[model samples]
Target chain A: MKIADVETPALLIDLDRAEANMKRAQDYADAHDLPLRPHIKTHRLPRFAKAQITLGARGITCQKLGEAEVMADAGIADILVTYNILGTAKLDRLADLHARIRIAVVADNAPVIEGYQARFDDPDHPLGVMVECDTGAGRNGVQTPEEALVLARMIDAAPGLRFLGLMTYPPRDDRVGARLAGMKEAIEADGIAVREISSGGSPGLYSAHETAGITEYRPGTYIYSDRMQVAAGLGTLEDCALSVLATVVSRPTAERAVLDAGSKALAADLSALPGHGHVMGHPDAVLTGLSEEHAVVDISACKDFPAIGEKVRIVPNHACVVTNLFDSARMIRGSGVEETVRIAARGCSQ
Target chain B: MKIADVETPALLIDLDRAEANMKRAQDYADAHDLPLRPHIKTHRLPRFAKAQITLGARGITCQKLGEAEVMADAGIADILVTYNILGTAKLDRLADLHARIRIAVVADNAPVIEGYQARFDDPDHPLGVMVECDTGAGRNGVQTPEEALVLARMIDAAPGLRFLGLMTYPPRDDRVGARLAGMKEAIEADGIAVREISSGGSPGLYSAHETAGITEYRPGTYIYSDRMQVAAGLGTLEDCALSVLATVVSRPTAERAVLDAGSKALAADLSALPGHGHVMGHPDAVLTGLSEEHAVVDISACKDFPAIGEKVRIVPNHACVVTNLFDSARMIRGSGVEETVRIAARGCSQ
Candidate 1:
């Protein structure tokens, strides 16, 4: 079935383009001799994970255990949960997943370490725990390398946990190289051999090799560059494989048109882009704003406004958040929808 | 099955509270002697649609055909789709739905009316078409009352379509009542009986009742007041029945604690709220920013910081968009989750 035959506001994945994106990232990893753990949180489809693994990805990186569980179900043996897992319910689920698959999770707190130890105490599966160091992003992780070492030692001494390495999601600043290098030396001073220093960010993907002690890389959104990627000068619009296929539901004037895909489908993320989203074909058109089910596109910037009922593709600002909005995306290949891949890990933010 | 028993970053709906919300709206409609056509787009749950119908709703209002289809499956007879039905594909689906149930769709353009006429020409089930007039939102609908009448005449001339009445989604400004009255007179001047002048909004629900000519009211978000609603002075935070249950994933500093619910869960809509989202318990703690998987809450305004692994509920700025992010929301009774209700119409943007 072609895209015309499918529903509007549907998640459309250009498979050939997607595969090319997967291979390009893999080729980059191969050229640099770096271990590539493609973040599954972007596509969240097991099929894409398998394709990445087939193209020689070292493993997969999931943001949540729920996402890892879906990947594991699809026979993904090695998984790295880049986020901290706390609470008995989550830790127990993590232990069960660890027992079945080669799994590792990052941590920065003693209570989280103690929780993991208490759950996987007897004949522990040697759950690999990475000390999450705050490189610059102020969301999570320890502030300094000394603080990371403290957490690392606590994990090493824990009954069921194994101190695997140091991990940090650094900010997209120029100081990332210095921060990583400084954190590495501090960990080494504590006599802890950092086996896998997993550092990742699409903006910092090129700088991965420069960071002296980095062993593996996990970048999710790079697989499908979005409006954010283009704005950050990471990738172009053509490199974006995922687009929201929406119809011009209303043409208020020659300058304005409203599409069916709104914040619900496109997501209201303005993180790495100028507005809510970008109209794919109409480069000059600006998605000025979005209501719940209506995307207000200002076509005054374009030479001509699209006619009402015209189907337009939109590249959302952030692809990862948009992926989580849908249960399945229509996989388009050579102008036809080949299959429907379920976004199985969608809404699994447990 | 307490809320504590359920994992964080989950969607919770207090059924008793939701029922109360439903009843209050129904009571208001009865007291004011107005037809309550509760918009189901907010919840997008068939059970809630059925309950609304059972609890004295005149009918149901849907923003899309997908949502209308979901409500139709639950035997919701009278359904008004408050959106322009564009393209042949959507019209065909609309025709099928019209045949199955009493369906009314709003359209603003001649081409949209032509498309509907061509599709439903057989006359087995004539489509009820309302001329959508732009009161002031500037999103969709005809700009002037004359434009509204022209569209109404076009629909009246069409063989397969039944010109029902005038419809307008007024802006959030204070001039809604006068606009509705003017549109009513314009349609009445053409010797056409305006059976329904449907006008309503969660923010303007009270004002809609004050409007002289409106026959029916359609308000969706009132059933679950969001941060937007609260900030708009429509309802209080205590009136919000739905919330994103998130865990403190990271506490990087005394000033910041990151919740697992990010843009994907809480939504990045700062519509009527001061910031991204509002932390429920810590009203002073503002959700300053959000990544795809982490919400950064600034607790510097509060005396205490949220500890890592602690659970916190977040009221998203826009509840409608938040519903679209998840497939199912856990229904809670008192403090515990009773069952998960599928947001069946999620991602059904077609």
Candidate 2:
């Protein structure tokens, strides 16, 4: 099917642009001699994950066990779950997933490590555990080098578990990278061989190599730079490969029009960006607000306004969250559709 | 299965509370002598829609033609699509739906009416058409009463289309209701019998009867009131029927705790509330931020912070949008799960 033939409020991924994006990031990783573990949370489709691996990514990173299960089912072996796996049911799933694939997980405290130890104490294959260091972004991880050592020793002492290294999400500035490097060195001084120091963030991807003692990088949104990424000076609009194709469903007034896509289609992630999304080809027009299925637009600033029934492509504020909104996306090359890839892990948030 | 046995980051609807909510709204409509038409966008389940109908709702209201198709397929004979139906693909679907069910639609402009006229101008059965009146919410509708009359006359003049009446999404304040009543009176004076003046909003559900000409009320969120509704003074936390069951995946620090459910499950809709969601039983805790599959909570104010692996229920900021995020929701009767209902209209946004 052609691109226009696909229904409105649909996700369209430019195949050629996506390939170029993957190649660009992979080249950067190769140049820096850093193993690129592309996070599949950005595009939950297994096909895209396989393509990332084929494009020279060492492995894949998943945020939840449900995502790891999807990657494992798709035959992607090496997986790193970047979040703590809590609860018995989830731990059991994690153990089963580890048995099939080479899986590594992260922990920030002793309680989380205890949960992991309970499930993997006597497994056939040892599970790799990493101490998550909190360099700057206060989402998850240990606070200091002393805390990292504490968790590292606990993982090393646990049965059927191997202390891998250290990992942190979104080391905002250079100081965080240097601090992580210091933590790694301190842990090594305690006679523990740090296999890898993983740090990740799409905003900080280019600077990831500059982070001292970092051997691996995990960047999800590099595949689809969004309005937030653009605002962060990551890349220009040309580098954004994903766009939500929406149709002008209503022209209520000269200044106000509504698109078929809303929070349900484009998501409500503000990303601290102006409005909900950036309307492509019409920078003056802003997405004023969104309801469940209506994206309210203010076109008063625009010299030209989109007419009713006309389709408008929007680069959402955060592409990674928008990817999880749709069930499948139309992969288009130029004006034609390459294929329809089902977002296999669209709601795999277990 | 049991409630605790269900996986983390799942949507759960307390069946009893939902029934109470639906009954309360239905009773209010009955007392006001107005026909209740519950919008299916809230629950999106055939069973819940059927339950609303059995409890005295006249019919169901859908936001999209796709949602209307789902309702019609589930034996719902009457439906009103509240958006301007544009484009040939969607018009064809609307025509097919009208052939199967007693369906009605709305339009605000000439082009949308022209499209409907092209398909239903000579149909086997006449289709109900309403002139969408933009009383206050400037999303989709004609601005003034004169504009409403123009669209109403166009639908009235069409061969196989019947001008049903007027409909507005959020009839804000009493002024909007008064204006819509004036528009209906003006159109009727022009020899057009405006049957069924429809207006809808959960916030304005109780005040719907205050409108002079509104004969029908459509309230969706009353079925599952969310944090937005609670903050709006429509209800309280006890009145919210839906909650996301999440597990404490990590306690990275004394103040920060992460939940397994994030934007993918809870949605990133900020409801003018302090945070993303309301953590039940812990009013002091704030959902500070959300990643794809992780919700970070600030637990500094809480006297007793939840430990790792413990389950916590969160009331999302917006209920309708949260309903669209899940594939299925667990129906609970007190502490026991009644059943799991697949959200039939989850991604019906074509």
Give the candidate number with the greatest lDDT: 2
Q: Write the per-residue lDDT of candidate 2 for residues B114-135, one digit (tens) a residue.
A: 9989988664488899988888
**How many clashes does each candidate structure show, in the order listed?**
5, 0
Each candidate: RMSD:
1.9, 1.3
Which has the greatest DockQ? 2
The alpha-carbon lDDT assigned to residue A226 of candidate 2 equals 88
State the weakest 10-residue window (summed lDDT) of model 1 chain A.
Answer: A116-125
Q: Model 1: residues >4 Å from true position, as ranges?
A: A122-124, B122-125
Q: Which stretches of candidate 2 lie over 4 Å from their true place?
A: A122-124
Evaluate candidate 2 and give its CAPRI docking class based on DockQ. high
Q: What TM-score quantifies how close candidate 2 is to the native fold?
A: 0.98
CA displacement after TM-score superposition, residue B203 of candidate 2 (Å): 1.1
